[model samples]
Target: MISGLDPSGGAGIQADIQAVTALGCHPMPVLSCLTVQDTRNVYNATATDPEIIRQQLECLAADSPIHAIKTGALGNAAVVDVLVEFLAAHPDIPLIADPVIKAAGGGDLADEALIARMKERLFRHAEIITPNGIELTLLGGDEDETRAAHNLLEAGCQSVLATGGHGEGEEIINTLYSHDQEPLYFYIERIGGEYHGTGCTLAASIAAGRASGLSARASIAQAQNYVLRAIRHALKVGNGQPVPDRGIPWET
Candidate 1:
């Protein structure tokens, strides 16, 4: 896992570790940045030195067998460049990237330059890039979700999973777009109330599923189910949004 550190433990590396572990995978967390935030909002963030991030990746790569890589809230373009380099060297490792631009409770996590770098470099190396409707539009540079997904596919991402949590409706329709197959949709009932760490948990769960040898479609389906359950058992740790109960018991 490559992401920022959220002291509140609702999202970022903390959520990633919990989600990955709950899915029966070991999380190799690498911090790309640090944030001062609570369940309500992100007040500020400081990017980790690019060289430090590179060194951590090298050490982890050298010591462990990395099955899959997942990333969230990379603070800047320099961090993205570091990841791009690492991914390029290990072309076979599957990557699941959550293009987190804004916090769930409303705060900017990534700026335009970082988003541009992700689209131009980091995304192409990912096996699947997960984005909410708004993120899809921003990353793909198109107002239309379908068109935006295609734009990403054209830019070399193997697959694009546009999450529907931010969209209007009773059902959350997460759509998966691939170069060789028709778009696949997973319809999940919309759970009421706002929750933090959902995007982080979902991306990590997908990475864990892939690492466990599930097919991309199967991985995505299982991840969605996991997130649903987690949300259903959300933890009200603070006065703001509830933190996802990522450690909740899995249903069959």
Candidate 2:
């Protein structure tokens, strides 16, 4: 299931839908927030009612057996609270969270209070959390990436995938950290030009892989390859940043 809905079809649940479908998984969308956005940036976002959120989740949970859950920009603390409680009741389902604190165009997505509560509650329930450099710093309240990842792991996430898109490097370095295993690094040549919604695509793809019964490690690897191909075929749909061509197949 997915929370955030993006009219742009560039990120949030829209992107999640495309990524999951591409990976041969059925998607069940549950909106926590709705946004007015294009390929450029988010103009405005409105939070869905917490009761409505619970209703949707309950309806889906009752009718269908959800394999995995992918969550994006939850609008406020109320939605976070509802989601946290719902996630707690379904502990075995893999949850992939893309910690979207800010948009690609530098728009503020979440407030300080929401972020804090998410770390305390939502993070503990996630199977794995995917955060870029800026988000990691904000969530961890520290500049050190390794330290921040460890902080998240200690907070309760089974694993953390710290993406390197915002970091300074000639080659992008994505790291996966788990409690009992050594850190695994995925190196990909940095694709030139800024693209929107890579994080959402990555997290959604990972969730899809997990839903298909792949282990976290295997899912991370598949997700990375999928995102890389999507980036390679990215489209300049609007005046601002290009969006990943999620409809394109990985092989072609």
Candidate 3:
């Protein structure tokens, strides 16, 4: 299941649905917010009522066994509280959190209080938290990638996938860090030009792979490969950044 909805079809649950379906799993999207935006920029995001969000989650949980959950761009503290309560009830399920703090066009997605609450409440329940370099720095209050990721780990996150896409470099370095294990790195040549929804796509793909019974490491590898391919076939649907082509065929 997903936590947010994006009308743009560039990120959030729209990207989650496409990525999950393309990876061969059914997507159960629970709307947390209604965003007013396009591929260009975000004007505003109105979070759904906490009771309605709670009802949506309860209905889905009662009807079917949720194998995994991928959450993106939670809009407020109320939604965070609702999600925390639900996560507490279902502790065994695998959760992949893509901490969507801001939009690609530089609009705030979540307020400071909501972010703090998420780090405190949601990070512990998540199996893995995927944060791009920028988000990691913001989450950890540290500029260094390794130190920032360590901060999150100390705060109770089991594993951290710190994506280097937002950093300035010739190569994109994605590092997976877990307790007592050396960080595993996946390197890919940096693709030129900006692309939308890469983070959401990657996180949801990982969730799909994990739900289908792949190990955490295996799912990370598969998700990175899938995102790279999607970027390679990215679509320039709007005037701004190109959105990833999530439906592109993957070579088996």
Residue pairs clashing in model 1 are none
By lDDT, who's the top model here? 1
What is the per-residue lDDT of model 3 for residues 92-166, given as tens digits with 9 covering 90 to 100?
Answer: 899999998988888888998989998989888899999998899999889998999999999999999998888
- TM-score for all predictions? 0.97, 0.95, 0.96
Superposed Cα RMSD, model 3: 1.2
Residue 128 of candidate 3: its Cα lDDT? Answer: 94
Lowest lDDT sum, 10 consecutive residues, model 1, at: 243-252
Candidate 1 lDDT, 77-179, residue by residue in tens? 9999999999989999999999989987678999889988998898889999999988999888899999999999999898999999887789999999999
Off by over 4 Å in 3: none
- Which ranges in model 2 have alpha carbons more than 4 Å from their true place? none
Better of 2 and 3 by lDDT: 3
What's the C-alpha lDDT at position 229 in model 2? 91
- lDDT over C-alpha atoms for residue 235 of model 3: 88
Q: How many residue pairs clash in each candidate?
A: 0, 0, 0
Name the TM-score of candidate 2.
0.95
